[model samples]
Target chain A: MDNSDFKGKNILIVGLGLMGCSFADAFRDLYPQKIYGFDINKEITNYAQQKGLIDEGLTKINSAILGECDFVMICLYLDDAVQFICKNMDGFKKGCIITDIVGVKRKIVSSVQEVLRDDIDYIPGHPMAGKERQGFGYADKKIFKGKNYILTPTKFNKSDNVDYLEKIIKAIGFENVVYTDPEKHDEKIAFTSQLCHVIASSMVDINVDDDISNYEGGSFQDMTRIAMINSKMWSELFIANKDKLVNVLDNFLTSIESFKMLIEKEDPKLIDKLDIIKKSRESL
Target chain B: MDNSDFKGKNILIVGLGLMGCSFADAFRDLYPQKIYGFDINKEITNYAQQKGLIDEGLTKINSAILGECDFVMICLYLDDAVQFICKNMDGFKKGCIITDIVGVKRKIVSSVQEVLRDDIDYIPGHPMAGKERQGFGYADKKIFKGKNYILTPTKFNKSDNVDYLEKIIKAIGFENVVYTDPEKHDEKIAFTSQLCHVIASSMVDINVDDDISNYEGGSFQDMTRIAMINSKMWSELFIANKDKLVNVLDNFLTSIESFKMLIEKEDPKLIDKLDIIKKSRESL
Candidate 1:
């Protein structure tokens, strides 16, 4: 339990799709004692083991397998993660530290923390990384490089456990570890992640012939690349964080409407407005 | 005049800005008789000569320089280009072919064609290439690689001159050449280029703290990269093409509003909508 290098630590990865398999691939480099993967899909489970991403694979969750792991990553959809953790609270080893890679924080963390065990620590996590295409077939450890791993630590989480999680994340190719409260994490993510996908999807849905790309420069390609989306997962995240996202959308509308008027009137002030935006964009 | 190789042609690059300097850099590889650059900024004109981007430099246009050139590329602002062409119409050598690199076609082409010299062929063009930064210092010929060059040929344009342009553009690294009428060019370019810029600028103008980028994945970065705006240039293009751009913006608002409602109601229909968007996006 005191091993900070993750040596001799048994790790469990639930829902072995992109995030789970990718995590398993990274943990192999850390030399964990065992990396066990569980998924409802037998094909993916066998595939992960065959690819050497996992040392063992489970098609179903069993207490014996779960009780041996020192850490776990619940890489399921938000509501499913809540259900999985709540239903199997007794299965995890004592003093085990678990995390999830779902994008939204408030809903999943609130639901799971409502009925979590005192003997184990669950630190809410969001790795700010993904691809437009989903599933294990597209999984690669390279996606995690230069990305951030956000940890929203609540009162129930121990300081040592949070530090250990950060250490493992850095080892797994994340460039930085960010700390925030659950509410603030959701708010920021709604703007940076969810709002961007929403805009890209809308741009594509405007229904211009795709041949219109013939006239495009790199900017249009960059702006709309994420319109190729994971529909089910993103739809769920958008709804769960609807309040913050819609508010951000409204602020965006106000800014664009002003631009509409400036263009309509051929206003000289638009130069100033765009200059301000340029400076703001550079600040990022 | 019939040589598609540009072997004996003197090419004049007007304005000596990003596009003009970059064009000069590309034309260097074609071994034109000479590349002459004209700019109000003496520093830039001298820099182009020093860098060997232009074989010769002119601080101001003249009948001596204009009369000898077999081809010209007007890289000035749309309004300035109209003025320059009108004032110098009589100076261009007979049968000299001229073109422009303006983003908006209808306004500039209409203004120039009204007073254009019949002896010289003037073709309206748009190179679907640029960078977020402007000016001669940032100019690089590599931007033209794997990009498109669009020519909106009018009845006034001679087919032979347009053919020569296609040859030159291909030699200078344009991957494709698209032909459209000036009006259709304006309409389609409004959506593909101008509207995308408007969206990126509005996203930046939303005024969130720059630190919000800490939570961003690449999607947000991609969506907002063009918000590092050439304020004066883009605001002018937006206003010049306002009617068409405003109409396109309305269509986008309608599409995004539907997304907002779907998110608000937590509608299952959102999954269907996003799937459609994903397919549409893939077409590009």
Candidate 2:
């Protein structure tokens, strides 16, 4: 493998939505090569090309273009991304390294490994970066700057491929690149990312009937800011990591129940719980 | 009662903590009168007086200074505020209107009404404004600006007394002074204020073992901002409003359970729940 330069290499980005376009925008200056994009939405593809975020926009998936690419990044939803790879696995060039930026990792890693050709590399990557809003209009190259990027590689992945992917991530401005097994990545994210959204959404759902505008303070606003979520994307992610998410959700409910019990009994232990939480937060 | 000029009137503020000093700082420019302050912590009283947030600092709860005040504001914890008022009920000037900025209203209102002299009026007030930090050091006059000020006045409260308290709240720069009964105040606050803290604390408690700094985003920060709470103050508020807080907590847990069930079943209804939360947040 030529590790010296990727200046003339071709990179194809599947799904020209926020994450895909963001990757194109971030890599455009670093790669110094052709950036091609494909989206199910023709308008997004056209916009990406017009905005110069990509060198070429694929109206239809073409094997010739796919076969010529040195790198492939799939940014579609979990199901679409898996199906796209399985359906077009033949189109990928030999030794080409493919990656993704999906929230969930274990399922995608398993699916990709199931049908992946021995010559090709599939490295599952997740960038802990996003906004509550979506679409290409909100895409920005700076989204990945200083953000944490996790790479979950199975036994099928080659060390050279992982190193190349890390170099690409670094070139795109990610300061922290962590390597973790797929299961650990999914479990930790269930608490850090998915659980917070569930709590925010639940908080918002209950206060919908109340005239909260008149009496809400900073705490309420902070807790519910993420309640304005992208439903379709989140639902897919939630379902993809159901076991871990459900476990975290159950543990969260247990914590809340303990609080309720303390309050119900008017127990002095309530202060201890608060102190524990405060101390935990200080550690963060 | 003369409503025209309060220039010659005296105002006594008990508990020279954040809320008390904040009221004094906010009201100093609005009311042309002597603002006296008293706290169990004599140092806070002295500091408040030295900072000119209060005109006179009471070393002890003297009846002479208390009898001359036309308005009294109590800013103590639920139990302490109740005990202080009951202990000093006879020291207050005749026909003076007393108010409080306690988070929970029902318990305080009931306690005050039970021991308050007929010559004095008690109106329960709660300013929906605060920071996670405590004490007079964090006090700021602008904390109340444009924030909601709720007055939970029962039938025992005189109409004129409610109007007079509203004027004081307005003078403190609160634009929205809402009037509701004590029960309603407790119920709404359980959802809007108290429950948020509980959710934040619980979220912090669960993620304590995880190294969140590596992957945390804006949502995590926003959700846990209130986790750095004043343990004693919040525990008291949670206990005082236990029934209401527990009710809201139960409903919130049910909402979480519903989300969990949807995720467990991989139901499409999860999207609908997310949309509902998103729409509700937009209303705010």
Candidate 3:
């Protein structure tokens, strides 16, 4: 299927939460077609429908209703993603490309593939954009305006399916798209995303009891800006992808230990190491 | 002396680093008068003079010349602050109010006071402002704009001297001015400034080899932003304020250990703890 195949197609966004509702709004605005939504919470689903984020709101995913949709986008919790895919297998149409907004792709992709038939192609994608504030009210149309959209499509996936998903993502106003292996994507995220949340959380916890109301400067604010992210969601996501997170954490702890040793020794050579890191940070 | 005392007063800024030069620029622009500067490196002093960051830059402090100055603002390395005051004690006037922009005051405030005569009041003040980029060239005139300026003046400091420093800091564009004890100031900075630097440096060192140019987003950049701080300068500062920094490090490490435990157990209960910290972070 080409870009024109998406022109009049029906799209279903499961889970009417922040990412789900955002997906519906983005596709509905750009695709010039109907966008449906499903969520466990009827209130959210109805609200999204009223706000024109979705054309239809459903409390349950039924085969009769989902069979009408050309594409299904799973926007659920990391751990719950595989379960949702398994339960809603019969709802998707034949040859429809399924994709996800899950942060980590390694396990979710594999688990989804295990349950779905070979005829149904699945392409995993993660939009590297979000805010500390969640919910449909906080969902922004400009969230992916200039963000990178990584498409993790396996060899089993057809070229047409990958192309179809890419067109949809591009139409949604994402600035860049990269096709990467699922394992590599998870590793990149471990260093870039998971490690960042851990460091912010750690820093915030360090000054948990301190009376820093009037003392904190811009640097502290900038560093801990993401500390307000939903911890329940983050903690779930953290453990769901534990192996990579643990590896990244080990690398971070080792570097910090070396720095502490340098500080303890009052060694001037610490500057050499810091200069190397500083150069890299600046380059990035 | 009152706020009007600074109208024609000659001021000496005793360091020409980023914060020092920024202080000079901030004050020089607002004071509309002569500002003298001294640095161990003649180049920095000369640069400050050439850049108009200071009116007079000198390699040596001459008592006859310095005695004419009304206020001496010491902005130097924490370790060298006491030595600087001691060596230049004979150069300053009898009733001159000596203030500092040092980070750790509990570490050196008493030592600095010990070197100065009773007639010369020492008010330990730390202006919570600066940029990662160092030197006089990167010094911005509005570095202190809307930022907090903290004055940790001891009881021995005259009320007029404290008020004068406050007025000067406010005139330089600081929106908030806070007063606290020296020991409390050091403890607060240990948590906010020192521990944050260590965390940032360590986190950056973790992915120093990663190709972060493409995948690193806002969160990763924010987490490691302060890793660009001068290691030589921070190394000296850490050792100079070893006791307080070490204490803060211990507490920080303890918090990190708690996080590691949360990960190990994959406990959902830890979200409550994270929620409390996140709320505290938002309030700050």
Candidate 4:
């Protein structure tokens, strides 16, 4: 089974949400042996199955279904994902490759590293792609197109398993696969993902008038587009990476304060500061 | 000249940069008598003329050019727009309706109101549309489509002239025309346009890595897209609207700080706060 193509693999999708169904639908096209989708709610898994996203749907932990899967994709939220995996640790096939689509890395990797069966390899990953919408009905395979997939591979993760996963990731339309450690992934993501959500969410929170979007050109709309967030999911992400997020937030506050001071004092250096920021952004 | 159609009107497009060229291009299709474009740089005016964005380009303010214009659209930066309008107040034709596309309204309307000729009516307006790219060459007439055009009409502005301006504004593809006083316009705009720019610019300024964009998903890109700032122009705008911008910035800082503290303390209320923010943004 070393470096096996997805065509010969039996896969399990642990949550029938947007990310789960998307991966299930993509894998269906690649002719996987069978897909067993698990969701605590039977309705979601049934809907996914009816949509041809998975070959079968399971409401309970069927040891046979879990034992047959060569690849298991856990698409649950942070704490729930850890709980699901740790509880079902003994059900997975020997040397089964288990990966997750959790947002944060440090907490997920550390928690999973403690209870995993040594025979099975666990790879922690984040697919940096999603719409503002959620749920199985909103799932689209194209969401993965032209997106980055970050892998924080534990030392126990087999190189062959990582390569096999990368093959499946690329086949599903991911444009880039970035390899890094759990700590580095969380730090960069804290800056790129969590910090942006914080700023966008705060921008929305400050609107004094409900109709203020009427005055917006394009800037306000673009900045706050992501503010149509799933609140529970995001708060969990924020608290999970609070240390890194707070650090980045402080840096952002400091940076904006300088602009405020420059404006407050009517300083001539404001132009230079704005010019430097513009040049830096243009490079990006 | 009472509520005249664009066909019989001669329009002047001042400061032939992106906004000026776009307006001129839109006016050409409406079959205005002639468009006299004014710019400080002779080469830019020549480029605009060669591109057919204007009928003729004037480097200096010609009394004949100013005198014949039934409508003068000042597309200059705030300070430059003020200087040009006040300096040439005497040259405008009687009952000529003048308007501006400056970001801030109070300053432009008040300055022009003090020295404006009684014979001619100045209707101050702000077109809530633009691209991050600058210059006439990048100007597109479609930028006005489905956008808001804000008007801050003064007491001296005649009813017929406001109607005349509204017709032209609608003809140029503006979807909505929002009417408010100068103070209200400044305040709302400070929250919508100026505050977004400040946040976007600061987001860029806080980047710890030049290669940070590589790690970004769509959120970071959307938030910082406007950070490609025109340093000198933006600095001028910030200083001009310092009081209003600072007030809103403080509110925004407070809002984000609440988020930071909520995350720092690992409070359960963070989810509720985020949920409220998400609902508020959805109402937009």
Q: Lowest summed lDDT over 10 consecutive residues: which window, candidate 2 chain A?
A: A1-10
Look at candidate 2 and tell me the lDDT of residue A147.
83
Global lDDT of each candidate: 0.88, 0.86, 0.79, 0.88
Two-way TM-score contest, 1 vs 3, winner: 1
Ranking by TM-score: 1, 4, 3, 2
Fnat scores for every prediction: 0.86, 0.84, 0.61, 0.86
lDDT tens per residue, model 1, B1-284: 44546797889999999999998988888878999999988889889999999988898788988999999999988888889889999999999989999899999888988898889899999999988888899999899999988999889888888888899998889999999988888898888888889998888787566677678777778778888878888888888899999999988888888899989998999999999889888878
TM-score of each: 0.98, 0.91, 0.94, 0.98
The candidate 4 chain A region of ten consecutive residues with least summed lDDT is A1-10
lDDT of 4 by residue, A1-284 (tens): 53335777899999988889988878887778898899999999889888888889998989977888989999999999999999999999998999999899899899988898899999999998888877888899899999999988988989888988898898889899999898888899999999988888998888878787678887888888788888888889999999999999999899888888999999999988888888888888
Interface RMSD of each: 1.0, 1.5, 2.0, 1.0
lDDT of 2 by residue, A191-279 (tens): 88899999989888777455777777767777777888889989999999999999999989999999999899888988988998898
lDDT of 3 at A101: 86
Error of 1 at A158 (Å): 1.3
Order of all candidates by DockQ, from best down to worst? 1, 4, 2, 3
For candidate 3, the per-residue lDDT at B264 reads 70
How does candidate 3 score on lDDT?
0.79
Which regions of candidate 2 deviate over 4 angstroms?
A1-6, A155-164, A167-173, A208-210, B1-9, B155-164, B208-210
TM-score for candidate 3, please give it. 0.94
TM-score of chain B of each: 0.97, 0.94, 0.91, 0.97
Better of 3 and 4 by lDDT: 4
Judged by DockQ relative to the true structure, which candidate is superior, 2 or 3? 2
